[model samples]
Target: MRIATGDDPFVVEILPETPSTNAVLAQRARQGAPEGLVVVTEHQTAGRGRLDRTWETPLHSALTFSVLLRPPAEQVPAERWPWLPLLAGLAVTTALREEGYAAGVKWPNDVLVAGADGDRKVCGILVERIEAATGSTSGPGPAAVVGIGINTSLTAEELPVPTATSLAIESGGLVDRTAVLRHVLRVLFEHYADWVADSESLRPAYVRASATLGREVRAELPGGGTLVGTATAVDATGRLVVTTPQGDRVVGAGDVVHLRPAR
Candidate 1:
């Protein structure tokens, strides 16, 4: 896919390969790099997914990149900063649907297609807050590095696990990586800018594209345990509301596995 000849959407820096684009940008942000800077590498050897898990992809077969965003503190509350990853997830999910893959997010921001076994992940989002050195959450509101990885051409054999998938695997062949990346970035940036401007609910669109909601799920809660229930809804604050036998619980962080209801 060809990037058009015109004003670039963001300042993009491309490398043949790298250990991790997020790592590169994190160091840059510490040195006072301005926002709108992006780093993309053809291959990532030490890429990290949520929960510190390693993310690996074939060289040149995916869009492995990170973009920096310094949302104006006055506009976006620090507590609401969690929406960045969700925003990125929604962007990728919409992009895939446009490409004819039935894509949706599995809470927070794991992009996947529903399958007989479970949701087969095609992308993962990791949003890191750029915190103050004094270990305080104050000051410049919130800075974030949004890392997105999309598998464009990985075959079934190349998938890291049976639960993982790719556009090639799902679409039956290679997709235009450049085209996919362009569309996703466009979608993410636009939605982000709109949110920063209006501070409204992105939850509606997010809820619509979420495969997690309305399903019986088993969530691996952060502190060490599990919560079993049906994902009833995603609240305005982006929390997953699960209706368990105990009560309605709002999950802020966890690994959710969509489960098939017992027959």
Candidate 2:
């Protein structure tokens, strides 16, 4: 499928340069922009990864973009909002696998490919929630700004970190940014729409494409604790289920570091 350039459900806006696609779309959402607004930039002066870390890629070397989502409360329960990023990760994993790349989802929203050292990250996702106004009986809404950044054409030296690899680097110097963008959007939107209707089909695909499963992991929890165990599965709500010594536990948010490769 070509980029959703025509009159389609998705309204894709391309920019030659921007500080961050998420920033642009967040402003639009506050201004009452409709759902399905996608902002893709060729360059980002202030791109960010999870936990507010900086993510920089050379101009035209990556697919950097954000999509706006306003999930209806009546259709998607509030508790399921955390699954948005996980679903997006699954979509990207599927798209890359179709392109003949051995991609896998690393919990929450990281897409990774195995490397000589470990699982090198190729994609990072940040999902920001925008809360609705208070004291309005006619209100119960929040928009999600889903930012996806993928390393496409970066050379080996240009990688942001030793644990980061680009598609060009991993695939022996062949990559297509436009096709990647189109495939990503098509898969993401299709799965997202279907998920909003049922919210049940995501886990099976995610589990199948996961790199964290069946591996020893140490999750750095957000509350200043760490959970170490084998990542056995992902529950229906997309939380990682770990078989820790304290018994089976579910981690809703964390930075998971795989201590061993998937068996």
Q: What is the C-alpha lDDT of each candidate?
A: 0.79, 0.84
Candidate 2 lDDT over residue span 109-209, tens digit each: 88998776778899999999986645535533689999999999988889877888999988996788888988998899888988998898777888899
Error of 2 at 49 (Å): 2.0
Model 2 lDDT, residue 144, Cα: 95
> Can you give the lDDT of residue 127 in candidate 2?
92
The per-prediction CA RMSD against the true structure, in angstroms, equals: 3.4, 3.0
Off by over 4 Å in 2: 1-4, 133-140, 222-224, 254-263
What's the C-alpha lDDT at position 65 in model 2?
Answer: 91
Clashes of each: 0, 0
Candidate 1 per-residue lDDT over residues 117-179, each given as its tens digit: 767888988888875455645444346989999888888788888888888877776588878
Most TM-score-accurate candidate: 2
